[model samples]
Target: MDTRNITYFMAVFDHLHFTKAAEHLGISQPTLSQQIRLLEAELGMPLFDRIGKKVVATEAGSLLYQYGMKMLQAERDAKSAMKELLSEKRGTVRLAVLPSDLDFQLVPLFVEFKTHYPEINLKAFSTIFVREEVLSHKVDLGIGLRGPADKRLVQVPLGSEPYELFVHSDSELAKKSEVTLEELTQHALVMYPKGYLGRDLVDDVCKKHGFELDTVMEVGSASSLLQLVEAGIGATIQPRGLLKQHSTWPNIVSIPISGPAPIRHLELTYYANRFVSKAHKQLSEWLIDFFKARTS
Candidate 1:
């Protein structure tokens, strides 16, 4: 079986349209159709059912699609392993992290990592969809909240941190050592927009408590949200580590959330079967140790 034909078949299966799949594959529709027919003939069975304008994968095609993904991933891993044999220190480690952590926490660690392993190219970016990015193979590793069970991913526990109320020193709420979820709703708050993982986690806790946070502002940027709290515009709820790492902003004080605090359990996730180059392994170990030190 030709991997090229399997690739074409997967494209068509994903799109469910011959022309669209062909366009995505950068091939002519007729050429893609012919390739599919060849693949079907080789398998001795029809791979797809074309009814009117619809295209649906047959049972055999569906089973093959699952294995096809693994086969392609294996091919990629083989190529990567061969390339790494030349030099273990010279490679790229792509990472995706939460926006809040990226903005306020990880810069120093990243700088330290780069200083030691300057030869290893590090491509790290902030995103809300950390799990999705890792699963799609867009990044070699991801740092985010704990994700649901998936056999393809191996999630190493990073650490758990509680979300605390942040406010300027002059704010009345800052005088209190702690605040309950109900009391938190009474005060004006600034938070991440809906659909963000952080915001969704906080919102879920609020819903369980039978009240919603009265957010006066919804800022997508973590820095901006902290800025608002620093300026006394509105208080915000975030991981305690955010303010702890950045002591430059002395005015912002973090107050613990009493009565079922919203805790964010973080993990370092990567594909279970993906090749782990030396550079990748080093970075992963460093990240795990970094979090452990912080929590300790």
Candidate 2:
């Protein structure tokens, strides 16, 4: 009848030993036995059979076990739903972000967010397609250089960061602290695939500059592209924030670009009209402020 009684019964059923069940439940053996007896009395049936020191489930107990699991699961779900309704006290927040954002941007924001809401569990990952992850419901939130996501998703524009080129110090392009898109494009380009929001901007910039890109490699992540550039393989473009952070890379030269001055609008997006808990709102606002403060 009582949820606690069901839980105790399940524990006893699992162990099939009174002492072990009592130990597992952190209740005294006599107390556990008395509770089980009371539960059996309430149900009007014997729940267990004692043969020597071991206890085995009777027909009634086996049937209760079947229903008890569902009862516990339902109870747990109810509590979670209630918490989400009340305070958004606890739940997992699956998040997708770009690798460059992880170290400098999202990670710090997450640190502050957790400080405020320690009960919120987080799973943050970096991938090329954060928008798709959010749209498919694989992640509750996504952070990236925002572009056109599915109309079904909601976007919260955080801020914008200018894109720049990362070239090896010895490269001819590195001679200039600032270069035009046409100048940067002269070398082999190591960049994310065209599907990526940042890469799409790069493609547009290249087209506007009147040149088809000499994309030598279409890597999935900014880190890999940066590595290729760092190895003196070619020049790659990335956000200025990432370029500044890795500016100390021995042979890396991060040069600002000027033309249309392409800027990436970073956004936090989630499914539109989904039941966003208060915790989610609070965390999202915290992130908005965090990026705003950093980028400002």
Candidate 3:
């Protein structure tokens, strides 16, 4: 079937009204009606049911609508990707990331990437569920904690960032150069909401060490968690890089996790067989060296 027919069907499905769909498509109502009739005749079945003035999809129409959406999206994406290839100079890479890693991981890496490919547009969204966006193919790449189930995504473990306990300088724990999970659990815990990698790591450590964390409060972002810890609300454990910018906060202390330090492996994930533009490949290579330099 022609893509224009698919586009017309999608336009109708979206608006569910003949006149509105035609208006959106910049075509006259009768032309849109004729196209729909032709599509139905081609399929040998009526696609929509006219109930008074309202339009509703028939059984075949619903199925066609589903496939039509996918086809049109794929077409648009293919055109966009091809345009980027033809240009050979610039393109956009959509990226989704967890909020906690925004400043330390994403922002710096984006800046470094833009320095080389200044024309490459990076569209980034900071949220907890970047994986979903990647899964839906809405974003070209993702940076976040790995999920439980394996799929088609290719994940490259960049490096694991260790977690550190934060305490106010005047607090007794601040006197120590390093603090263990056991020691940290002795105080009230300020933490992230459940399902966060850092919070889960802290919980796992506390469980293994035969103690339950005294979680006094939970916040959404790492920055806010650090702010709460600095205010002496309670101590919290977070990735080491989170401490970099907040290093100068007065009365703030970062104590390394003792024993087997729980580390969250940062990964660069993308579709296994999906197209990787020149800019994307360069950014990926840069990340490899970037993390290596930091770890080294």
Candidate 4:
């Protein structure tokens, strides 16, 4: 039997009312009735039994309904699969990044990306452990300062941005365009709260220099930490790219951290074992290209 006739039969079977089924199917009731009759004639049995105004499926009709459900689902599945294969619809990509990275114009870059690929959806978030999110397979992509990620994941390096010393304009370090980590250590430090990447980086560097960091203040958030630094409470170190992000900060001097300068590499990473969807791959490539153009 034709699939259209089968579909019409199921519609009538569901509604059990010719006029209602026809209206739902966007067809005339007489046309629906004629289609049902044609299907019944082909089957050599009455699919539905009607008594006065009531309608009920017969034994044959009950059996057909069971198969009809599967048939419609299979058709839909096939169409959807084809659409995906053709890239007719670009699906969603789950991405995790650092809050500082967001200030680096990543959000606007994603907006531009979405403009080109209208069907592709990009859901982004900021968290300290972007690498951990990728390791756990909780996200499709992670864009952040690279650290010890699981070697099992594929890391695509975007570029590296050097860390700079953020001090008050009147500070001695401000007199020089470049300062060493050892020199920045002479000033009181206001670092990010413990367990943060920036804090860990500074602590590790200081340890290598045979001294532990003595933080005068530890702020939980970047904005709040910058606020304290803006008030000249203490000096801090951050990526040059990150400093540019909050470029409106007043009375701040970002001197380059020279003499064995520690740097953070920005990267996009994904699980190596899992299938990388087209959306994920495209976004990753776009990020690398965008950063290259930016740093160039």
lDDT, candidate 3, at 264: 79
Model 3: per-residue Cα lDDT over 1-296, one tens digit each: 89998889878987899999999999999999999999999999999999999999899999998678567657756776897867855778887777777744556678878887787888887766777777657688787775665567888777777888788787888778787777665788888888876778878866886876778999888778777878889888887766664445767778887775677777778766566778878877876676545444
Candidate-wise lDDT, in order: 0.87, 0.78, 0.78, 0.77
TM-score of each: 0.86, 0.60, 0.72, 0.62
Candidate 4 C-alpha lDDT tens digits along 195-273: 8887777777777878766689987666666778788899888776655544578788788877776677778888675
Residue 18 Cα positional deviation in candidate 4, in Å, after optimal superposition: 47
Query: Per-residue lDDT tens digits of candidate 2, residues 1-296?
Result: 88998989998998999899989999998998999999999999999999988688999999998788667756655666788877666887778887667744455667877887798998888876888787656677787766775677888888888888888889988888698887655678888776776777878877886776778888876667777988988998887777544434778877888766678788889878456666668877777776665455
The root-mean-square deviation over C-alpha atoms between each candidate and the true structure, in angstroms, is 2.7, 11.2, 4.8, 13.9
TM-score between candidate 2 and the true structure = 0.60
**Residues 1-296, candidate 1, lDDT per residue (tens digit)?**
87788889989988999999999999999999999999989989998999999998999889888788877777777877887887666667899999887876778878888887788889998998899889877789999888788898999988888888999999999899899878976788999999988898899998997888889999888899988998888999988777766777889998998997789888999999889988788789988987766655
Error of 3 at 141 (Å): 0.6
Q: Give me the runs in candidate 2 sitting further than 4 Å from their true place.
A: 1-81, 84-89, 99-105, 111-119, 127-136, 145-154, 245-251
* Candidate 3 segments whose C-alpha is farther than 4 A from its true place: 2-77, 103-105, 147-151, 208-210, 245-251, 294-296
Ranking by TM-score: 1, 3, 4, 2
**Which candidate gets the maximum TM-score versus the true structure?**
1
lDDT of 3: 0.78
The true-versus-predicted C-alpha distance at residue 69 of model 4, in Å, is: 30
